[model samples]
Target: MSVEHDKALAAKGRHIALVIAATMLGWLAMSLFIGPALGLAGRYALLFDFAALAGFIYAAVNIFQLWRMRQDSQR
Candidate 1:
């Protein structure tokens, strides 16, 4: 049981890390290239910013959950 729980935690951690990395990189790419290439206005760029913000928030919540799970498991 403990082994399975640990594995699940590891998987969750990896997923959260991936989400954070992807959000940052994707936001950078869109802001730098896609937006300018498409000639998006400032308001339109905010859409991407908002999307990135959501992704980061999701990752943060998941990370907190994972931390709590780890703490409980340790105890």
Candidate 2:
């Protein structure tokens, strides 16, 4: 493979890693802070709901990636 190809692949990998890490951290931070604060704000606020929705989205994404990795491994 060409040097350019290698550099591109590395760059792509780095980007993906950064995104995944950030999402994971965001989920963690929200769960720890905004989630509970919203929950304590009585039954009208949507902070907890937002956290739940974000958790589901991130979980789905991570699961999809895992499934894809499994598929690739099977090949």
Assess every candidate by TM-score.
0.93, 0.51
Each model's lDDT comes to 0.93, 0.61
**Which tens-of-lDDT digit does each residue in 31-53 have in candidate 2?**
66775766655442355456656
With a 3 Å backbone cut-off (N, CA, C), the pairs that clash in candidate 2 are none
Best by lDDT: 1
Clash totals, every prediction: 0, 0
**In angstroms, how far off is 48's CA in candidate 2?**
8.1
Residue 36, model 2, lDDT: 76
Candidate 1 residue-wise lDDT, 49-75, digit = tens: 999999999999998999899889878
Candidate 1 weakest ten by summed lDDT:
1-10
